[model samples]
Target: MTFLKISKAAVIGAGSWGSVLANVLVKNGLDIKIWTRESKQVTELNEQHTNHHYLPGLKYDERLVATDDLAAAVNGRQVILLVVPTVAIRSVSQKIGKILQTSNERPLIVHASKGLELGTHKRISEIIAEEIPEANRAGIVALSGPSHAEEVARQDITLITAASADVAAAKTVQKMFMNDFFRIYTNQDIIGVELGAAFKNIIALGAGALNGLGYGDDAKAALMTRGLAEISRLGVAMGAKPQTFIGLSGVGDLIVTCTSVHSRNWRAGNQLGQGVPLADVIKNMGMVIEGITTNKAAYELAQQRQIEMPITQAIYQVLYQGCDIKQAIANLMQREGRSE
Candidate 1:
């Protein structure tokens, strides 16, 4: 299938990752527009060239612009990037779908959000396909990996995966975003890529919780290793290539999110480990902790599939079931030895 040659793109969210992606597109010479709900944010981006709330102290490209109007954002764009939090994907896609119905264009749809839908257990691509009409969407791509917006904003060397069932669409995105500082690799396993991206957060939370509980690097390493194994198990069960977990979206992302200071999920887990209430931890975190909700969804998915994800189960119990962190860790450690 011949894909649309992307020139102008719309990034539908002005949060940290969305703003960073908009910058990447601008550097790639695409006419980029970022849509946000706040008029104040648009004013800040247009006049000051910064989004202080999300990406503080980082100056954005003057060529990159922001708008509150959804129609204005999507009207003639060749690619539409969905970068909102997981909870907002359906509502944003529904609004975009209605506006695109009248336009004579089909734009490549890429989502950078990482989390499954809570109730439906659907990936972001599935949610977008459900909300947007087939005629309006060129293809749904999952852009993921160990990319942190904080580092990307600094033009750090970041490698990411652009995965889609439609290889052409993934290639189109790879061409649009690749650069010296930012690299894009294409993968066909959208299921594995998306699942790896989502499920790794659960492990990151566990890592952070371990740190908060005064455990050293050895404990974090063990948790991340076991976490990846369970991640691969669940991904393979759901029709994802097992090796995808060992790639950028899986082990790579797990490493970054678990270790980086910029990881909100890690910070949240640390607070939980320190005995702070989940509500307080989330409240103090000015960002969306995708792991919290992803933990719930993954726990349910594991139960439904009968997958053995002990780390995910332990994290879920601590977060949702009011289980003590020490007891949870003890229970995990005391489990019968099994084959590696």
Candidate 2:
């Protein structure tokens, strides 16, 4: 299947990643529009060329524009990128489906969000397919990897994965966003790609909790190594390719998120380790800590599948139960030793 050139695209959220993606399109000479629910951001992005609240101190492209009206942002676009938080994806997708159902164009739908739906345990691709009618979509794609919006905004060299059951759709997206500073690889294991991307946050938060508790680098290293093991176990149980965890979407994303200063999940966990209440840590963050919610979902999933996920279980106790981070770490440390 071939098509007309992907000239104009719509990025359906104006948060940090969304804004950076919109600017990437502009950098690649595509006409782009970013939709935000906040009216103030429209002026800030369109007039001032900035997004101070979500992505401070970064000057966006003047050619890139923003709007509060979702319909105006998406109509007639060749590619519609969903960059909203995991919780907000369903509602936004439902709205997009209604507006575009009768339209003539079947635009490529890509999601950059990383997290499973809490109750359904669904990936982003599944959620989009449920809300957006297949007739109105070219194909569903999951764009993920070790990409931090903070670094991407600086035009730092980044490599990422674009995965879809539809190989053509993945290739289309790879070309759409590839540039000198950013590159893309295509994958067919959508399940492994999405799961690895989402599950790494659990490990990152664990790393931060260790840091906040004044633990040495040795402890963090153990957590990351063991973290990948459990994440791969659960992913395989759920039909994902095991090797996908060793690839960019898995270990690569895990390292960056667990170690990067820009990781909000790690920061939130650090605050928790420093004795801040979970509610207070989340409020102070002023950003969606995907791992906080993902912990609940992954823990429940592990139980359902009877998967051994000690790290996820420990983090879940800290976030959901009243278990102290120290106690959680202690519990993890006392687990039965197994050969690697």
When summed lDDT is taken over every stretch of 10 residues in candidate 1, the lowest stretch is: 1-10
- Candidate 1 per-residue C-alpha lDDT over 227-261 given as tens digits, one digit per residue, 9 for 90 to 100: 99998998899999988988999999999999987
Alpha-carbon TM-score of each model against the true structure: 0.98, 0.98
Per-residue accuracy of model 2 over 201-300 as CA lDDT, tens digit each: 9999999999999998999899999999999999999999999999999999999999987999999988988899988998999989999888899999
* Regions of candidate 2 where Cα sits further than 4 Å from its true position: none
Report the Cα lDDT for residue 167, model 2: 91
Candidate 1 local Cα displacement, residue 224, angstroms: 0.3
Global Cα lDDT for candidate 1: 0.93
lDDT (C-alpha) at residue 87 in model 1: 97
Alpha-carbon RMSD, candidate 2: 0.9
lDDT (CA) for every model shown? Answer: 0.93, 0.92
